[model samples]
Target: MRSFVVSVVSISLVASAVFAHSGVKNEDVMKRMKQMSEMASNMKVLGAMMKQQQPFDLPLAKAAISKIGELSAETGKSFATKAEDPKSEAKPIIWDEFDEFTKLADALTKDALQLQSSLKGPEDLRNVMATLGGACKQCHSKYRE
Candidate 1:
């Protein structure tokens, strides 16, 4: 399990390094990416705990989920301006259907809150992560490039 966690984090780090070199020039786009990256980092920690790679710490789980909730709430505001960058993964349809895009982000925040409130152990974490991940996938499929 520990080896699996290390492999996952290693892959994420390598991918992040590659993306970092992709010449993302727009400040707003960079901010958006940074926010998303932070959320992903927190999720990775929770995921390791959920998978039993690491011992579950309720306080740490709460902190990570709380941060995700805060970031999810800010998603709409981050993308509200329709900033562009060659490296941006956001699709043009986001601005075209801003309401729908933001609705998804809002739903993510709600999911995070639900997760935070209901999280008691690894089992609950697993369920909540699935819901949160589904929310993310739904938005990405529609609004991300």
Candidate 2:
């Protein structure tokens, strides 16, 4: 009886391991999620700087915008390759409307690039920030929880 119980427990453990490997690990998805969260935080800081009409720190704004663009690109690539990752916060609607998600990601990339290019002055930066915010809202409303 003890041997049979041990065999059953070992089989359960192996089955769970197989199930766990079948889906994305939470750690991997959380890493990417944290990156996206950080990018959003940086964008918020840029927005606050713009609001204060600070001297338009070109280098800082450039770095922040570039990072945001990079994050957007990474998200797009991830969705393309591993859209079905079990740990993804992305809704099922995202996969159902995959083309739309791609389009939004492309739009985000364009908006970020535009913001990076037009970071000439405070007003231009504000305009770009507004555009970026709109793009972000549009995507989040549809895809993110």
Candidate 3:
């Protein structure tokens, strides 16, 4: 678990450095970008564990799921006002179809919460990914660039 946390922190640091050059000027947009980056890093960790590239630690897996759920809950609020930035991947249609966008965010939160509870072993993580990942892809395909 300690190593997992360290890995996530390292990824976040690197992502932050990269995002610094993404040219996002709006503070809110930058914050959103960072949030999304963090989610991606958590997903990467989950993927590594699922693939057996990294040893699966239950605590770390739970922690990652928890962070994703927390972030998913906030996703709607983050995009509530249609803040714009040059490097943001969010599509303008998000604001145009705000309800649908938020609904997808809500679905992600629900899926994550459900996944967190159902995980019993490494194999469970693989199953969880299919459902959780599908929710993410469903939203990103329509709402993100």
Candidate 4:
């Protein structure tokens, strides 16, 4: 679990650094990007705690999971508009297969809520993180370019 979190953070950091300063023009799309960034930041904290890189903070993990749940609940609405920004990685298939996208978003919301409710310790996060990552990949593979 520690290794997984490290890998995700390392990969995401490298990816973001490589593509820093996007040319996205739309405010709406930018908002979504910011939300995703925040989510990743939250995950990084949890990962750190889980890996013992930081002190175990149950409240922080709970809060992060809660925030994820809250944000995920609105994901469908957040992407409701067909706003286009060249900097956006979202693919056209998202609009074309809107139902499929929303379905995955809804599933994420549910999983986040479940994680928040059931989270007891780092071990729990370690187990649930895999599930969360899978949900993200499912949406990303189909909707994200």
User: Would you list the clashing residue pairs of candidate 4?
Assistant: none
Cα TM-score of candidate 4 = 0.83
lDDT of 1 by residue, 1-145 (tens): 7678767876887598557747888999988888888777778778888888778889889888888889989999999898999888999989998999889889889888878887887778888678877887998888887
Best by TM-score: 3
Which ranges of candidate 4 are over 4 A from the true structure?
A: 1-21
Q: What's the CA RMSD for each of the models? A: 3.3, 15.0, 2.7, 5.2
lDDT of 2 by residue, 1-145 (tens): 7558546755765565445445566655555566666566667658756886344577878888888888887776666544345666677787677888888878888788877877886667667777888888898888887
The worst-scoring run of ten residues by lDDT in candidate 1 lies at: 13-22
Summed over model 4, clashes come to: 0
In model 3, the runs with Cα more than 4 Å from the true position are: 1-17
- For residues 18-135, write the lDDT of model 3, one tens digit per residue: 7564777898998887787778778877988899878888988988988999998999888887898777788898988899988988988988888888788998877777887888
- Per-candidate TM vs. native? 0.86, 0.71, 0.87, 0.83
Task: Using lDDT as the measure, name the better of candidate 1 and candidate 4.
Answer: 1
Each candidate's lDDT (Cα)? 0.84, 0.71, 0.84, 0.79
